[model samples]
Target: MKPLVVIPARGGSKGVPRKNIKELGGKPLIYYTIEAAREVFDDDVICVSTDDKEIKEVVEQTGLEVPFLRPEKFATDTAGTRGVLLHALKFYKEEMDYKADTIILLQPTSPFRTAQHINEALEKYHFGLDRVVSVKETDANPYFVLFEENEEGFLKKSKEGSFKRRQDCPKVWELNGAIYIINVNSLKNEEVSEFRRVKKYVMDEVSSIDIDSELDWKIACSIYYNIIISRNIDSK
Candidate 1:
């Protein structure tokens, strides 16, 4: 099935400041995602949806298409991810008359994904699966170790507290938001319907980094550097 790559980048970045365009390892952070997509898909099929002119320029420099800019309203901090994704999907269909069986939603903050990881996720997305996302084994399983705050301000366990041993609890998956390949039908039908069947392409913690803040950025860099060092072994 044909695929379309969508990179959603907005201008206002509060955490890291101009994060999407910021250089990571000498290349703009978004460049990694664009490059990986290029390695796996044609340039015409890849699209970067952004609101900032600077971000658009960075995307074009990578030789990717910025088919449409997300509306300022939708690009605001208040706009939810679901709304942003729905708007992007609608834009390509309505404005560009583009259609793809698979809509690949890749977050720029996740730069560690390799072309191999992308292909692995795609391999899981056969006709049987409705959606596929990059994920990693969670160190702390939410089913066992998570907590919830009650209205009385007491910290209560998210699940039953009776499970005395962490190992006894079932393992649960946490989405790493790196790469997601969702069926276009389910995407337009309900904006990533929670009820839709989903699959995962599990990656190691090193490559599964989700850079949400300064700390996350640091951790991701460490992981990236480590991976590079390992690859350089015996090359000398």
Candidate 2:
């Protein structure tokens, strides 16, 4: 299926300021997502939607053109991801006259996600559905470990289950903020937040690392360094 890959990297990052352009694993963080997209699809089909001029310039240095700077309204901290995606789809359709059956949203935060993960998710994607979002098995098991305060201020299990051990409970998944494959027609008709029919693309914990805070960034760095060290040792 023909797909348009959109990598949204707006400026005004509060956590780890300028994170999109910040060096991670020896390169700009966004470069990882852009390169991964290029590995799977033609460069022309991959678009970097950024509101900051610096981000656009940095992305251009990677040899992939930034189709357009996202509008200021969509770059705000309160702006929803769905709006940014819709604007991108509109730009491609009206300006470039390029029509794609599906859109693959790859957030720059997920640097560990690679072309292989995207290709596997694409193989599982089918039209007429809302979306296929990447996820990882949640480390927090609500059934046995997590608790919520009741109206009476008493703690209660978040999810009631009879399992004696957390491992015995049914597995739960959470969005990894890595990849989202959406049906173009479905996206145009309804916002992604409103979609009820969604599928999950499960990824391992390390691959699902999404850097949103300084702690997360540090963890990513440690993981990256370990991988590099392992590869280098094997090469010798």
Candidate 3:
């Protein structure tokens, strides 16, 4: 089945301001995702769904085409990903006279997610599944220290478990906000939030870094620098 990689990058970023095009590790943050997608899929199938003309120009500078600028309504902070995905699908069908069997969402926030991760995830993906999402071992497990206030306002364990030690508790996974491979038919029929037959593609801590705030941006810069330094040392 043919796969299309959709990158949702709007101009109005409240967190870091123009975050999608913001420079990270000497390149626009969105450039990393675009480069990664290009490594796995042809440029024609990789769509950057954005409402900002500047972002569109930046993406095009990478030699990957932006089919069309997304509508203003879908670009809002209040907009949902479901609507974005559907709109891209509709565009491909109506305008390009092309259809994709699978839609892979590679968020620009997860800059560390690379082409290797995408290729590995696709290798594991098989037909008939609802979706495949990348994840990392969560630091907060519901069975452990995580808690929620009850109706009476007393704190209680988020999930019930009798394990005496945190280590003994079952390992839990959290979506790393990296990659999402969704079947087109399933996406069309149901919202991604409602998918049941989902599988997890595990990644390490560094690769799981998702930039959402200023602190996250700083942390990513540190990590990126360390990685580059490490690579340079290894080469020599």
Candidate 4:
């Protein structure tokens, strides 16, 4: 099956100005995703979808193509990721005559994901899994979560279950936004598969950092510094 790697980046970043192109560790943050994609797929299968020219250039330098720039409406801060991805898929199908069996998303925000992670997710995705995403076990269990009244100042349990300990509540996973492999036709209208068909590809916390905020950027840098940068390996 043919696999396509897609990277979505918006020019207007409220958290960190030009966040996608911002220097993290040493290279532009987009470089990480670009390199990781290149490692797993050929140049023809990797593409960058961004509204920013700088991002396009950076992606091009890494040998990835910016054949299309995402529209401004879908690049806004409030825009959901599903919109950008669906638009990109439509653009490729109609304009470029490309139809991939699987479309994998490698968000530029999560810079620490490696080529191995991509391969692992793909293995699961091709094994009849509709959707596979990189996830890490959430530290806070939903079983112990509380819900406060929006205005009336009332408090209650968020779910029906109340476990004696967080570990006893079973496992809950959070979409790290690092990687997602989905069937191309499955995203016809931007709605990912229902939770029932969605599968999780477990990743370590160190590799699951999604840098959308200033605070998140700092934390990512620290984690990378300790886990990757300091290890003397050429970071992607």
TM-score top scorer: 3
What tens digits encode model 1's per-residue C-alpha lDDT throughout 154-178?
9877867567788877776778888
Query: Where's the lowest-lDDT run of ten residues in candidate 3?
Result: 226-235
lDDT score, candidate 2, position 216: 89
User: Residue-wise lDDT of candidate 2 within 2-118, one digit each (tens)?
Assistant: 788999998989888999999997899999899889899999899899999999999999889998989999999999988998899889989999888899999999998999999
Query: In model 2, what lDDT does residue 206 have?
Result: 86
Local distance difference test scores for all models: 0.80, 0.91, 0.92, 0.81
- Candidate 4 residue lDDT tens string, 1-236: 87777888888887888889889888899888888888888887787888888888887776666898788888877888777777777777788798777789999898889899988988787635668888999886667764545456777656658588776887888889998988766676346735346788999988888998999989988887887866657543
lDDT (Cα, tens digit) per residue for candidate 3, span 151-181: 9999999999999999999999999999999
TM per model?
A: 0.89, 0.95, 0.97, 0.89
User: Which of 1 and 2 is the better model by TM-score?
Assistant: 2
lDDT of 1 at 186: 78
Give all candidate RMSDs, comma-separated. 2.3, 1.5, 1.2, 2.6
Judged by lDDT, which candidate is best? 3
**Cα deviation of 41, candidate 3, in Å:** 0.7
